[model samples]
Target: MTVRSEPVLVWDGAIRLVHWLMVLLVPLLWWTAEEGHMDWHRRLGLAMFGLVLFRLLWGLFGSWTARFAPMVRRIGALPSHLARLRQRDSTPSFGHSPLAVLSVFALLLALATQVTTGLFSVDVDGLESGPLAIMVSFETGRQFAEVHEFNFNLLAVLILLHVAAIAIYRFVLRQKLVKPMVTGRRPRADFAGADLPDNRARPAAMIATAIFSLACVWALGNFG
Candidate 1:
């Protein structure tokens, strides 16, 4: 007779909300750009920026599972982790695997770069400009605009790679990655020998952080 283990919570609500919001808003950003809707594009960018800020803060002061310390500490063992994966060792991690942590860092860096460049970008006509365009020369703003365009393409590539990785993990490796993000829970058997901690944070703290992040973004969008 086989014994089934209970499900364990792996993700917090804030993490799920940010992850799904990014999923929706990123495509929306591309669509708005294609339609030449700069106003809406800017608004979407601000929203994304706020979300990113919230994530950065959450990674520091939120749940233990969401903190960057564990991820950073595990970086040294990434090669070993990859080796184990190659050997078909199915040692499951309760939080992000080392490889997934690298991808997360890469995505965050790419989006932050895109957002910063966009703030100083100028249009071809020089009529429409980013909020910070006035702080720089036309040539500088134009350069930022070029970089902004290139960074978006890079971001798209990263996003595609992310999706491909998820598919590979799900189909090829027979792992369930997406369900945990959506449901915040996974079968306890999957992490049987792993050190799983209760890493939930207060909902009120998450709300306060999100509101503060949005306020900062609003101030930046208006005054930067």
Candidate 2:
């Protein structure tokens, strides 16, 4: 049973860092690509690459609230979740709600697609190209570039939906999703009967994930 009390931790710092950094990086990546700053674009792409990699690692090994298992149970429960949303009484999940889980997967898939395609993408003159562009034929690299651009559109749409969902949570549902994300805590009153998650991210997990992500990114850059 949930009790009203002071704010309690609901997110780990690394989880919050990955979320907000991606928020800032997505727009900057878009701008850099649009402005033809290929140098900075590649650098920023690597940074984004590292962040996404870290998150994937986090999903597998991080704190309880940041893991991937929660996305499974609630798939069939989505229509019910939406119905509750319409009634302004949507159930609050300790970590992610059903629809929020879907959004997370969609966004991550889109981003994964974006970064994967980008690694092999190539420009018209073969001048501005991904690190792995050299591994493929120019024609294939160009094709991947096209898919990369197309996937950006898909990613943009999902991002817009994410923002809209946040707005709904804040204004319509009267929930403070962003605050909990930033501060890593939520008012204990919000969860009526749910147990608090084991929100603390262990130092060992964080360090290992960071090192592994960097090594993976480094391997990709070097192997390409």
Please list the C-alpha lDDT of all candidates, in the order they appear: 0.87, 0.86
How many residue pairs of model 2 clash at the backbone? 0
Model 2 RMSD in angstroms: 2.4
lDDT of 2 by residue, 1-224 (tens): 95558877788999999899999999999999999888888878888899988888788888887888765676778898888888899567888888888999899889888898999999999888888888899999999999999999999999999999899888887787888898998777778757675677688989989998889778876774
RMSD of each: 1.6, 2.4
Candidate 2 at residue 130, lDDT? 89
- Shift of residue 45 alpha carbon in model 2, Å: 0.5
For model 1, residues 138-158, the per-residue Cα lDDT tens digits are: 999999999999999999999
Pairs that collide in candidate 2 are: none
Q: Which lDDT value does model 1 have at 22?
A: 94
Score residue 207 of candidate 1 by CA lDDT: 83
What would you estimate as the lDDT of candidate 2?
0.86
RMSD, candidate 1, Å: 1.6
